[model samples]
Every structure is written in structure tokens, then in C-alpha cells.
Target: MYSRKKGFISRSSRISCTTNEVTGRYSSGHSEDNSNETSNRYLSFRGFFRTAHGSSKLFLGCQNFSSLVGTKSGIEIDSDLDDGFSELEGPTVTGGMLETNVETELVEDDVDGEDVEMPHDKLELSDSESDARKAQVPEELLKAITTAPVQSLDKVMVNWVEKGNDLTRADITIIMFYLRKRHMYWRALQFSEWLELKKQLIFTERDYASHVDLIAKVHSVQKAESYIEKLPKSFRSEAVYRSLLGHCTSKGYTKKAEEIFNKMRDLGFPVTSFACGHLLTLYKQTDKKKIADVLLLMEKENIQQTEFTYRICIDAKGQSNDIAGMEQIFETMKADGMEPKMITKSNMAKHYIFAGLVEKAENVLKQMEGEMHLACRYLLPHYAALKKADDVRRIWQLCEPNARIVECMAAIEAFGNLHKIEEAEAVFDKMSKEGKNITSKHYYPLLRIYASHNMLAKGKDLVKRMSERGCAVGPLACDGLIRLYIKAGEVEKADSILQKAAERRFVKPKVVSYLAMMEEYSKRGDVHNSEKIFYQMRQAGYVRRIRQFRLLIQAYINAKAPCYGIAERMKADDVFPNRTLANMLSKSDPFRKTEASELLLYC
Candidate 1:
């Protein structure tokens, strides 16, 4: 409806303003009025005074937690987050959050003191800013793109770069930002072409190395290497080579990485920590003769070796029956006044354990304490595959009170290989009494053990503990919880867990989660949620999953809902969801019940 006398028109959409052609003033509108078309994640972050939200470390460092806006002032911190992760622990990163807050202000209104369209643009890109009362898009993209789906922006970027008419230096930077974000690897080849057109393009040495890092962040290790190749001779610095070499190693390009090591020597770039780590990782994954040849090559090239050079020998001989060689290297390292790293010592211990010299391994474990204790804590589980609980306990005692959660969890996990369920539970029970809150770290392992032991109720209790402790329930625990629900014939509880997994974007709602949910809907014949997820599975791009589809179809049948041709459609497609879902379908399909029915009948 509109006022006809003044010829006024209706205003709509969220944060959308109507422009007056004559005055150029924004027609004021309702912020509350919004539709799904404009419900951007970043926009909602700003509607809450973008400054406060940006400056808060929790929201900045956190992932997928922007949905917490609707909740009251309460944060359910996962034990696995900063609190539990002692390795990356330091003072809470409030400063980064604070900087984000400032960035948020820049978003709401431009620095020039003018109103922009919506609150979503701040999180979007802009080329530059200064103290002014005018807001402009600058005809360029922003850096550090935090968009949800970089894939969605492919068409936009392809059009902009191909035309090359509507662009600025900042625009190119935005291009790099998006390219790196989306890992649009093909775009780099285009960039190389643009560089040829205008010898000096947007990338300078100062930021080129960083751009390489950005590419690595997006998992474009090969692209990162390619960019290094294109860097001009004058601009090709040591920092550039180091970044490329690091990327090569990360991407498992062993041959290219070795070549980079030689190039670094030729360029006379200092062999920093990065160079050592990369070269050593490559040599470790290769043969002993190859590693020896690499060392000789380094010597011939006049490139001095770093302490990590010895790691090659350690990796080669460690955890194997090569006891004599490891002993000789340890003796040489001591004689050379180059302290054998704890890794070397731990590797020696691994050899002892492999050789079944339990007493010698125990002596080595005793001798290795303090910081080295942490390294050995990780090693003990591998060696303890053949040893006893006392050996594991001895190593655990050597570890600092704040040993890595992975290391601690490893000790608990090693129990299964030894068939030590009660002992494993005993450690968990002791940790509980000590008030050491077991999180997802312990949750999955304990759940698996319980399920294997037929202690379904206990597994469910562990999941409940995980939920209450604010531990993120992962797929493993979800499986255990569903199994418990099935054993007790509590299909409803199982379905609820499956639905929870689907809501949180768990990669694949395994047969456990899917089956339990389907069974619940089958027992009650409830097809509403079942069909919704069937569509959700398609929306999530898992439609070929026959198991998931069949679950929905069978649930519909049980509920007397209709899914008449779904079975044929599934088989017409890939006709398989996953193993578990496929099994369920095989059992329930009356027409082709060969696999599932045979298993059911025989079992």
C-alpha cells in the first residue's frame, strides 16, 4: 500500500535505502525489516555495535560462533578451545579483537562521517580510507576477505580480472585477496599474464611473500611456489625463497623442495629455522641413502647445516631395529658438543622399545625428564604397543603437569591395543576424581571402549558428560550415543542426536546418526523431520547417498507418508549414501534386499 496523493512508493528489504534522485538523501528505513536474501553473517555481527563485537577476541578468534548473538551475555567455552589447548595458550588475544572492533566502526559508517547502505560493507572490501565525511567504494576490493563461500564470488572475480578496465591498485589487492581465499589457482596464471602486460604489477616484494602465505592458508601450495617463480630478480629475496620452500614441503613436493634448498644456497640466503624444518621433513620421508646424499650436497654447496640436520638421522633410525646405528649417532652428537635434541634421545628410546629391551628403554625414559619429558610422552604410546602399563605410566610421570592434551589422550587411547579396558576406565575414573575434566579428548576414546565392551549405557553417560561440560560432541561420540539409544530401544534419543549433527554441519551424518533418526521416525512412522533431512541431504549436496534417501523413504512408509519412487531414484543415481546407510537400505528394500537381508537373516 502507498499514499497516492504524494505519489509515494513502498520501501522494503533490510538496511536497504531508497535514493531520492533530486536530493540524493537516503530515505530512512527499518533495520528490523529483513529477509533471507540479506541475512549475511557479517551484517549481523555489526548490528551489535560492530566495535564491541570486533574487539572481543572470542568472536574474532572463534569459528562459526556468530550465531551466539541471540543468546544472553553468556559464553559456553569448549574445554578443547583456548582453555583446554595449552600448546597454543598465552594471554587471551584481546588486542586482535579490539582491532576488529575498530574495523567494525569503519564498516558501520565510513571514516568520512557519512552513512553507507547497510552494515555489511565494513566486512566487505574497500581500497582505502581517511578522515573525511564522504563514503566511497573506491572501485576496489578489500583485503583479508572473511566471506563464507569464496566459491560463490568466482563469477564476480572472473569478470573483473578479464575486463581489467574497472580496476585500481587496491582493486588488484582485492583480487589477490579473493584469489588466495578461494584458492582460485587458475587466477594466478592470469595474474602472470597481467604482469607481462605491465612489467610492474600490484605485487611488490614487501607484500608478495605475505601473499604467498595467504595462498598457503588457502592450501594452494603449488600456486604459492609459482608466484615465487614470477618474482623479479631484484625482488626475489631470501624471505621469498624460504616461504616457497616451506610451502613445497607442506604440499609434499619433495623433489621441488630439494631443488629449492640448492637455490637458497646459490642465492646466499641465510638458512633459517624454516629452511631447516622443511629440508629435514623431506629427507625424513625419503630413503637413508637419499638423505646422506642431500647432506653431502649441502656440504658441497657450502651451505652450513642447522641443528635440525641431525633430525634426518633420528627419523631414519628411530622406532626401528637399527639400534647400533642410532647408538653411534648419539655418541657422535655428544662428542661433537652439539647437544643431541630430545627428539634424538626419544628416537633412541623408541629403538630400544622396538628391540624389546624394556629395561634399557625404562632407563632411557628415567634419564629423559623436564622438557624432554614432553617429547617422550608422545613417543611412549608407539613404543608401549609392545610394552606394559608401567612403561606408559613412567613416561607420563616424566611429562610436565601441563603435557600436551594429545599426548595425555594418547596414553588413554593406547589401552585398546593392549586390551586394557578396565585399566583405561581406571585412568579416566582417576582423572575424574582429580577434577581433571575429560572433554572430547577423552570422550571419543572412552565412548569407543564402552561400545566395544557392550556398555551402551555407560557410553551414553559419557556423551551426556561431554554435553554438560561444554565439550563439542564430535561424530565419534555421536555414533556411540546412537548405539546406546539403539541397544536400549530408545530410537527417539538417537534421532535427536542425528538431527543435532545435521544442524551443526557434521561432514556426514553416518549411518549411526542417520539410522537412529530413521529408526525413531520408523518406530513412530514420523516423516516430517525425516523428509526435511532427506531434502537437507540434497541441499548439503549429498543426494547420491541412497542410504540417506532410503532412510527417509522407509521412514515415510512407516509413518504412512509417501515416497513412492525414491528407491528407484537412489539406485538410478549413485544409490549409496555411505557404508552404514547402504547396509540399512539393503536390509529394508523388499525388492532388492540381498545384502541387508542376508546379513540380518544370517546374524
Candidate 2:
């Protein structure tokens, strides 16, 4: 380090100095130098400032020497910072400001995109060009997605093909297959136009069998036969043959099913367990004994015994009310290393239910809980039939939280249809406490439970809670409120509720709620109120159900009016007699000829 007084830096810079200029830069680091006199080739500040015999005055640049500000400090040289090029050759170091030259070159290097080779501070959050890439999906596939009626897909696909667009049969198959699988069965036919173009390619037995399976799954038995008859010989794979017989068995098509199974056997696919299973179901349903013998013979052939075969056996035992035989099958399954899975337990539950052994059936259901889905299939109906709401709740409690939601919701529906609203609410409360998700199915049942039990206050509280929890309170809940008000004999209140729901843009009222209001009016024997609500129902797009017609018919019969055209229409529309209709007919003495005729065909 070197220092000079701040006011005299220029004067110090003018001090004469001489030394080997190269020594200031590279000479100090010189391990090798080419010179004859080695000591003469080096110079130091001691020799340079010892004496100056030349006119050349050497000074540190003004800016470089400017910071020497002290009278108490002596000028001292301490070497630290060095750029290797500082004194390499014969070039004048004296020029413009020294630090400015270095900054100029640094800026130039930065603009020219060259590395300055200086130690630099690291940068934070530095970004580059590579972050902008996006995912790409094929344009053709995107264009195929349409919200229009599916009938349009077939035409679009045809145009694509005719226009030499690179779409394939596989693409068309995927779209239609998904459509049917998603329960868009009616819409799936629209894709048949596109499918027709690929008929020749897709008409193989395997493809036809797959289509038969699709039809069976969709519950389109009538369509299944029509399509099966139209299929070519190449399209009747083993599965197709089995599906045709399977359909027959399900619909109790014994002769047709047996015929198809026999034909399958003739075609050398006789070893099929599915065909055998259908035969067993046929015999079981009709009380034919030959099914077991035939099934046993096929089993001995060392062919794979499927779960469906055991299912048939279980069904047969249940249908015959053969409890011992069913137990025998359960033992056989265990001995054969087949654990009692949900399907096995479900069969037992079904058998027990038919036998009126509710406790035993419940034990079986609980034992198989979560081991399979559809365990609720047997239990939901059993509880509904027995009016056992607590039984339904117990079964759901034994299920996983997710499975419980699905099962309990189903139970709620079954109970609601039976008008056991209290039972449905009890199950729903359990579901809510169990921390299962609430869905739309749970909504109406919960609302009706509140209404039927005269707990509309609680019901309104539930609706508010649902909104707070971000759950959807659809129109069904509002409709339920309307019925509750009517059933509680607050007709004006019910009307107000309906108006509020409509103004707030709740979904449309369900048909049952409308019918209930109309029925309430009919119970008052008030024709005017019933007709007004009935017309409103029509304007609201509700079709008159059989029950609705019966309600109105009962009111007319109670009036005992002679047949005008209106009364004739009401009589014809009556699906079944209500209490008023029955009472009216009963009042007419048995000797009344018209009343006697009416009683015979009343329902």
C-alpha cells in the first residue's frame, strides 16, 4: 500500500521514479526469464527511487494515488492485488483515469457476451429461456370431443375419414365404448353410424362377444338379441355364445337359453363353465333336478370351477329354500381353500333373509362388510322390508367410512320410498357422524326425514349447515320443505317456501312433492285447490303419476257427482282407489249393480 496527503496527490504523482516496468506486473512472479546477466534483468523500488538520472518522471495515476489522506501515516507499499497483464510489454500506462479503463473493458465484455474472467458475486433467482415449454395434445383428438347429441359423432367421424383425416377404428371404438360404459346407452347408438364403417374390420368373434358383454351390462336384452341375430358366423366367439345363454337365463328364457347352450356345445365350446352356470340357474328357477348332475359332470372334467358356478349353486339353494344344502356348499368352499368372501356371505345373507332369519342374515352381512361392494344389495332391502332402521344403521356402521356412505344412502332411499322417513333420518345422522361424505342421494331423504317427523326446524338448520360446509343443497331439499309445510297443514307457508326457492333459483321441484301438495288438497275434498296445483304441476313439466291420478279420482268419487266429461276422465285415469273412493263404493249397498261392477275392477 502507498499513501500521500489528499491535497498533494498530484504533486506526489509527479515525483520522478525509475524501475524495470515489467517488475511491477510479471517480473515478481518470474520463475524463468531469458537474460544473460540474471541480476541486471531485475529491478526493485529500492534501486528505482535510489536515484533518477533520466528526464522521465514516473508517477502512479492520479485516481490510483488520490486516497493518500494523512499527515501521520508514511507512504508504504504492500503488494496484494495484481492483474498479470499490468506490465507485460512496452506500452504507456499513463493515460486517462485508471479504474475507468478496467470498467470500460468489463462493460464491453458483458455486451459482447464474453466472460470477464473476474470473480463475481453469485446471482439469485436468475431465469433463462428454457422455462416456457408447454405440453401438447393431438389436435385431432381434441376436435373429436363434442357436447352435441352423440348422433353427431357418427357423421363427424365419417367426414373425417372421407376427408382423408388420420382417424382410426380404434379411436372410434374408444369413444363409443366409453359412452356406453358411462351409462349413455341411448346416446351410444348414434355412434353406430361411424361403427358401421368399421363393421367389416370389427366383425370378428372376439369383437362381437365383447359387444354382447356390453349389451348385457347395459341391460339392453331386447337389443342384445337383435344384434346377436345380425352377427356373422365369425362373430360368435365362446363369450358371445355364453352371453346369449346368460341373457336367456336372467330373463328366465329356459328353452331359448338351453338351446343356445346346446348349440355352443355342438360348436365344441361345451366345456364352458358360464354356459353350465346358466343351465343350473334355469333348472333352479324351474325346479328341474338335472342341473346339479350336469354341473357335477362338467366339474369332474378338471375344467376351472368359477365363482359364478358357486353363485348359481347358492342361488339354487336359496330359491329351493334348502338351508342345509347351502351350508354344505359353504363347507365345500372352505375345504377347497376358498375363504368366505363378500359374495359368499352375500349369498348366505340373501338365503337367510328369505328364510326370515334376520339375525343370521345380519351376521353374514357384517362378516362380509367391505370384503365386497353390493353387500348392501341384500341388507338395504332386508332392512326396508322389516322396517328395521336400526338394523340398517348397524350394517352401515360396520362398513368402511366410504362404503358406509354409499350403503347408508341406498338405505335412506329404500326407506324413503316406503315412507319410513324417521328410519331414513336415523341412518343419515349416523352417516354424518361417521364422517362420510354427503352426496345428493342423502339430501332428499334427510329433508323428507325432517318433514315426515315434523322436524322442519332441524331440517332448515341442516340446510344452513350444508351451505356453510360447502355441500350442495339442491332443489330436492327445498321441495321437501314444501311438502313438510303442507303435511304440517300450513298450505300458505308451503306456497311461500316454493316461491322463495324459485326466486333464489333452486333446481325445479321433484314430482313427488308436487303430488303430495295436490294430494293434501284432495284430502280436504277441495276440487278447486287440487285442480289449481295439478295445472301448476303440468306447467312445471311434471307428468301425472298413477298415484296423483288416484288421489284426484278419490276426491271425485267422494263428491258422488254424476258423470260429466270431467268425471269420466277422472274415473278412467284412476290407477287405484284412494280411501275416499273405497268409502264411496262401500256406501253404495252391495245390491247397487254399478257399485258391484266397480268393486271388481276398482284397482
Candidate 3:
């Protein structure tokens, strides 16, 4: 026997033990020594066994068995054992092995000869119980998990689960759906991984497909393919293949996309027009020839071509400079009872422009006038480039009523480029009356007209209006005003305007404004003020051009200052003076004429 506190028997007590084969109990006879009494009392072997009916039983040894030593009946035990085993043993027994028979009788009495059945516990819950478990997810916890940042999602989920919420499969499915719908694919993938790994939830094929799509979108196509390979063969279906093909086409992995497309065909999957359209668009960039093969494949596979398919084919033809091929595709598209989109018409106009067919381009613009405003914008610049002022006006008049701001602005720029001030002013006034918000853009074009035509009063009024409307006057308008002043020979007025514009910071002075001031100062033979303006322009980060350097060198020579250094400065800036400037410099400084001619060589 072992002491309960010490958990092991002490060595002082030595007792001999005998087993009863009949009763399966061990009987220990203790010594009659008082010094070892405590050890004998605490230490004894108890037989441990289980009944046939599966109930556990322990046969404890009698502490004092020496009282039965002289008796032939049975080993004498304590009063509790005597009462408990009275039915199994008589007042006398034959040998010590009879103790085993007695213990077996005790075990049979405890079991009562009854047969036991194993417990059958179900692993899965019923539908009602599952619903109740799903209801255990708190509304607040659900909201927090869905709305939390991706970085903090793990912490939020762990805290919710720790608070005794049962995150079941239904709850996880709902959360994943919400995340994917919101385009939070990365977060959805993370949540799915946590559910399957941490919670031991098994996901179905649809769930796995969602995971694969999220991986493809947030990570890469290669990672998504690796994930698909790891999945069971039954999970790879037509939907999964189509999704992968779509991603490949979007990323421009042309070779990988073709392989997947061919695999789909070999597997007897339906080739969809949407997938074909993406593949064809990819082919349009690198290999126009391959487009026909894809179209032929679609036809052979009985896959219907969409309007977008025809559009891609036409664009491919246009890219290859095959105008006749493009027109043929356009006719075939119309013959199929499909209307061409705005983008298709734009491509046609571009092809016409490439071929220098201005009339045909104008006709296409007119055809698209009521439906699109961008046509006028595209054709206006073309007309301006050809100096066709009448054609520019015609395109402007043909713009739709709902024309965008950029379209109107483009028309105004074209008019300005063609030197048609009246038309430009008319367009500006029309824009203002049509309730279009007149900003700085509208003022700059008209200001150019004013500068070119010497309309000083109008230019000043425009600048004043810009200030009154809380619109900062831009550099273009400032340049126009200063130029108008200089053209009018009002040198002092131009200098004052430049000075005020620079100091006020409402409008920063550009290089054009500085150059105009420098020219005016040079014209008045005020080389000091001219050089001052030139240095200021340089400090403003304006690159020193040959024309501007010529002006400065002329100013230095006219001022009779040391002029040799000007040529050296020009050479350092890589701006060699031209013939007119070289002759002027040679006459001004005859000693350095050869140096100027040599510097001209570097030009």
C-alpha cells in the first residue's frame, strides 16, 4: 500500500503476498512487529480489474490477516470485509488461494451479472441544433469582423471566438460572401484560411473556387494555378478554368492564356464569347495575324461572336494599316445586324486620318455628331493642322448640345491656332451664355487673340475680370498683357506690369514676360535694367536658349561693358550665336571676332 500524501510505499515495511487463482485477489500477511505497523497499514497491493459487464472493480487486501492463521476455514479479515464477503466464504476455508475466489465473488456481486452496451454518441448536430449554434454568433461581433481592417481582422476574430461565440460554417460562409462582394478578396482569402486551419471547418467546391478566385485577383495567376493543382481533381471544373483564362488574358500572359484556352477545348468545355473576346484583345497588341485564328476557332467550335469580337477584329485590322481589311470587317459587322460602337467609329476616323483622307474623316465626324462629342474634338486638331479654318468651324458647329468641356476647349484652341479671332470670341461668348462656368481656360485663348491683334484695352479688361472673379491670372494672360504693352511702345507701363505681377504672387512671371521686358529695356538702351531682368529669368529656372542669349549679348555690347565674357558664358551654356548675332558681336568687339566665329562651329 502507498500513502496517499507521499504517493509511494516506505521501505521499512516488508510483507509477503499470495494470489488466489480462483478469486483473483492478492492476500498480504503482515508481520507482528509494532515498529512496522504504520508502514503495513499504509502499504498494500489492491487487485484492479473490470467486470464482464464493463464496470470497474478493485479488490482491497485485508489489513490484519494473522487472526485466521490457525483456522482451516478462511483467512480472517476485518469486520467490514467479513460482512461484505459472508455470502462468498463460510466460517472456514481450505487455503490462501480461496481469497481469489472470494474477491471474484465480490466483483460478481458488484456487477450483478448484467450485460453492458457501448455508448453511441452522435458527432453531428441536427438542423435545429446547428441553427441554434449559428445564432450564437453575436450581431456586434459579425459587424466588427466584416468592417475591421485586414491587419486587425485576426485579432478581432480571435477575441470574438474567445468570448464564447461559435463561428460555424454558416457564419463563415456569410462573412466570406460579404467580403468577396465588397472586392476585399485578400481579406476573404485570409478569413477562409483561418476557418479551415484554426477552426477545422471543411469547405465545399464552391467555397474552394471562391478561395482560388480571390487568390488569383489579390496575388497572381501563378499562385492561383498552384492552389488549383493542390485541390482534388473533382474540384477543377469549367467555371474554374474560365476564371483562370479571364485572369490570364487580363494580365496579358498571352502564351499561358492560349494554353488554357486549348486545354478547355480538349476537355470539351464550352468556349464562351466573353473569354474569346479577352483572348482576341490580347492578340490585338502583339500578333494581329493570330486574331483570325482565334476567330476561326470560335466559328469551328460553334461559339457565337459578340459585338465586342467584331470591334476587336476591326481594331486589329486598323493597327496593321490594312484599311481595306478594316472596311471589310466593318461591312461584315453591319451585315450581321449589329450597330458599330462609338469606339469603332473613332478607330475608323483615325485610320482615315492616317491615310490623309481629310474629307472621309470629316464625314465620319459628321455622322457621329449627335451621338458623341469626342468626334468633333478628334477632328478639330486635324483640321487645324491642315490650316482648314472653314473645316474647323464646321466641326465646332457640329458638336452635340451636351458636348463636354474638353470638346469645347479643343475647338477654341483650334480656332486660336488658325488665327480666327472672331470665331474664337464667338465660341467663348456662346460658352458663357450657355451657363458653362468660365474659368481661366476660356480667358487664355481670347487673351492670345488680344495679344496678336494689338487689342490692349480688351486684354486689360480680361485680366481685371479674372481678378474680380477671384480667379488668379495665369502666366499666359500675364505674357499677353505685357506683350500688348510692349507692342504699343509703353516700355514703362510694361515694366510696371511685370514688377506688380511678380510682387503680388497672384500670377508668377514666365520667361516670355521677362524676355519682353528685357527686349523693351534693350530697345531703350537701358542695358543695366535689361541685364537685371535676364539674370532674374535665369534664377527662375528658365533654360538659356540661343535667342534669349543673343538678346543679352546685344544688350551687353550696346551698354559698352566687357563683352568677351558674354561669348564665353554662351559657350558654357552651349548656346552658340547665329550669323546675325555673330556679325553684330564682331562689329561690337572687333578684338574677339575670331572667337565668335569659332564658337559658331559648336552650334
Candidate 4:
């Protein structure tokens, strides 16, 4: 067993810097320490929530990054929420920032010689009657409900249902799906609330799970958990808890994720591979050492590992620079009869290239040559990282014959990384010429290239072109714009972009965008704007990490402003200062000598 005390990161380990020169940002490490004594008992993942013996309700894993959700038009929408939504008011987007609902279907199945209906069967519509009910749906209902104000959603939904239009579960699901696809999470949450209030349908575990997921998206995870408590005990199944766990993992809420995992076991749900896999994913990103604990628990319980489980293990080892350990995991996976997919091979090659094992990476790429058309996107980046411009061109030539939007995107990134700005622009120009169905996704890589090279005029021209083309504006593009203005010393212009984007409720500014502005202000000793953005970030529901506190304190020091309650603020956020931040705090708050002295040991 891993040492329980080792799960918590010491203050000494938190001094690393997160540098992004293109954005003119500096960040202190964001690791969370798990020092609570109560957490030790649950360090092992052996007690996580699992499917009961002979149960039909199996836990569904989170969707893969490349997994596509089918829509009426067959557009492949990304399932990850971090990409943010594009300009919702624009014409129907051919590409960029669309996501789909990947929830498991609520269907009945036979398990252990019994016909078992899944939880949340209330969320499903009868196939035989669905077509008839769908035909009865009012054409105006979706538009009227989704486009209405949050305060008016209830009235609109109620009025539509009372008008005698058949509202089936399928209709409700489609509404939620489209709303989410458009990145109208707030409107979706309102629709869900209206559904819950009507009492027209009895909600099951799946319905509650969907609501909790939406709540976490629109509001905060804390609110989502509170909503869970108010749910009937029967509705709090393994699926519901797993939904909470998945959101927490995505948001990097390590402490809260552990609490939910422990509660799952306390509720008598046995350990399942799905729960363990989530813990592995969480640890892999935040604290790789803790991954061993999860692996141990899986071994002790004899849980059959899935391909995703092996992938996470390989990633954790690769991230830690344990090449031999990573290879061992890959070998073990094959021994267990798990076949690696194309993406898996890409990730392996990526790590190998990062490790400077050029021959090994090339060998892996050779293995992938059979699927070169599909693998070109991955191959281009790997070769680009190796600085092999010829190989990048070679892969492009292969892809050039029938290059899809995704291949073009990879080529842009690869050429940009190689500082082939002209070549990158050439790709963009070709996309425009070939009528490649461009979206904001295609613009971001070139925008990033411009920002990195301080090509302010080019970046501005590109933004104008995007506007002319009606490509959706999203946080990623806005982030690129912010970096461009900051690079040109047009800080106020960058600030204006952030403010205007934030005003659009659907277009939330990225954490990096906020940090870029805050960092610039801090360097100039502009405490007022620094403090303003700091509070804005908090109000935006961003968990304040040590980096924000460090920047805020630096602003106070530069301005020669006396800061009060800095220590209290840090404590409230559970963000303690590292040595560098400790010194900054001492300089900014001279009166708090006692607190400064307490933090100075690291200094």
C-alpha cells in the first residue's frame, strides 16, 4: 500500500512556475494537498461504487475526446465542455464547439435470468408511440421555450404543454441536446428546472443524474451536490454519484472528488472498474503518485481493467518520465488482450517523442502507416515536434489529396509549431480557396501563430476575416485576441475584449484570458484593475488557485499598497503561499508579521 501521508503534497513541492510567454503569464503550481486526517481511510479506491451483482444498470464511462455525437445533419460534435461554445447567433455552424449528450440509454435488458429495466426508464419514450408523439409536438415549442427569458421558461413550457401538444421524453431529450449543442447551458438548466417543477413525470435516477450534470455546468459543483441531497434516496444511484464524480474530475476538484468517492463506498456500493478509472484519471492529471494507490486497489479487488484504464496508467507513467514503467504497462495491456486504438498509438508516439526516443516514435508511426489517411493529423504533430519539416510536408501531401477539416487543423498546428508562419497561412488560404467549410476551429491555430510571432496586424486582419466569414467567436479565439493585444502593449484593448465577451452570458472568458490581463496589470502596478479582475474571476465561479493569489499580491507590492486580509483570503480558498508568494505576501502586508513569519520557513 502507498503511504497515506504521501497523498498530500507538501508546501515545498508547490513552487513550480507555469510560464506561457505568448500570453505574458506566470503561474504558481495548482496542486491540492490532501492533508485532512479523515481522508486517509478512503485513500484506497477498493471501496468505490460498483454495479450490484446481476444488475442491469452498468456505470457508463465519460465520453472520449474524439467521440462524435450524431445529430440530424450528421455533424460530429465534441463532447468536452472546455472548448466553450461558438457565436450562437451566427448561421448554422458547419464546424467548431458543438457538443452532444452522451448519456447512456435507459433501456431494459436481461441480467441473471431476469428482465431488468434500467434506472431512469421514465426518461425513455416508447419506440412504438414515439413517432406519433413526435408528430404531435408543436413546431414552435422548442424555439419558444429555449429563446424565452429564464424567468419566463416555466410559463412558456406550461402553456405549451397545456395546449394539448404531446410532450414525450424523447422531445425533452432532443431539446436538452440541441440547447447543449448550442452551448446554451443556462437555458438548458432553466428548461430542466421547469420540467422538475411540473410534476408531470416521475423522475428516476437517470433523470436526476442529467439534472445534476446540468446544474454543475450552469451553476457550481457545490450547488449540484446540494441538489443531489434534496433528491429522493432511491434516485441517488451509482450513476448519479458517478455523474458528480465525472464533473469533479473534469473541473480538477480533487478534494471534492475524493469525498464523493468515499461516500459511494459508505453507501455500500462495491468497487467497480469505472469508479477506479475516474480516480486514476483525476490522479493522473493532478497527482500522479496517487495513481499507484488506485492501481493497487484494482489489483487487490481483481477488477477487470478496461482499455481506458490501461491508457490512463500509461499516461501517468509517461507524464512522470518513467519510460520503462510506461512500456511495462503497454506490454501488460497487450498481455491482457487489450488492443490499442489509433488515438492510443498517437498518444504513445507523443510521449515517446517528448522523451526524445525518436526511433521508437518513428517505429510507432510506421506501424500506423496502414491508416495514414486517418493518422495524418496525429503524424503531422508528432513529426513537427521532432522538427522534421520534410516529414510534415510528406504527411501533408498524403492528406492534401483528400484533406478533411481535421487534417487541415493538424497541419496548421504543426506548421505553426515549426515557425513556418508562411506555410501555415498557406494552409489557411487553401482552406478558404477550396471552400473547406471553415469555422472558428480552423482560425485559432493560425491566430496562435500570429500571437506568438507578435504579428499584430496579421492577427487583426484574421479576426476581421473571421467576422466577415461569420465564423463563430469563442473563448479560444478571444484568448488569442487577448494575447495579441497584450503582446502589442494594447492592454486596455485586451481588457475591453474580455469585458465584452463576458457580457455575452454564453461566452465565458477562459481562465488563461483572465490571467493574461491580470498578469499585465500586476506588472504595471495597477492594483485596482488587478483586484477587479480577481473578483470577476471569482464571481465567474473559477476556483482561485495560488497563481491568482500570487499575482494579486504582486500587484499590491508593485503599487506599494498596503494589503489587509490577504492572509485570510488565502486561507479561505485553501491556497497557501509557496516561498516566492510568501515573500511577496510579506512585502505587500508588512503589518502581518506573525502570519508572514509562519509562512517564511519555506523562504
Worst 10 residues of 1 by lDDT: 67-76
lDDT of 2 by residue, 447-535 (tens): 66667777767766665554444333334555566766776777877765554433322024445555667777777776776777777
Which residue pairs in candidate 4 have backbone atoms (N, alpha carbon, C) closer than 3 angstroms, thus clashing?
A: none
lDDT of 4 by residue, 1-603 (tens): 122332212222211111121012112222222223223223212111111221211111111121111111001112222212223223343333222111111111111111211112222233343354344344588768654654787888888878888877767766765565455666777887877888755676767877887788667788998998988888888878877777676555667878788778768777787778777776665554445456546655678778888787666556555565567667767776889878778878977987899999999998887898669888998989999999999889888988887788789989999999989999888877786456654677888889888999888778767756755565667778888889988888788877766665433566667877899999998999999999987776555366678889989888888889999999887665656778887777767657567899679
Candidate 3 per-residue lDDT, tens place, 157-231, comes to 789888887777666655654454333455567777777677547766556656666677667678988988887
Evaluation by lDDT, superior candidate among 1 and 3: 3
Model 4: lowest-lDDT 10 consecutive positions: 66-75
How do these models rank on TM-score, best leading? 4, 2, 1, 3
- Ranking 2 against 4 by lDDT, winner: 4
Clashes of 2: 4
Evaluated at residue 89, the lDDT of candidate 4 is 25
> Which digits, one per residue and each the tens of the lDDT, describe model 1 over residues 1-603?
012221211123111111222112111211221223232322211111111123321111110101000100100111122222111123332323322211110111010111111111111123352211143433343332222132334444455567775555555555544443333333433453444455535555545665565455344556777767777787777766666666555433454666676666666776454465565454343222234334433433455444455544544545224454456445545554677767566656766876787878767766665555456554566546655766666665665265655555566666655667776676566555454544443566666667556676677566555545544444445556665665666666555555555543213333334544555565566778777656654553333433456567667557654455565677675343444555655545556645675899877
Clashing pairs in 1: 54-101, 55-97, 55-98, 55-101, 112-132, 112-133, 125-142, 525-559, 545-577, 546-577
lDDT per model vs. reference: 0.46, 0.47, 0.55, 0.64
Per-candidate count of clashing residue pairs (backbone under 3 Å): 10, 4, 8, 0
RMSD of 3: 43.8
Best by lDDT: 4
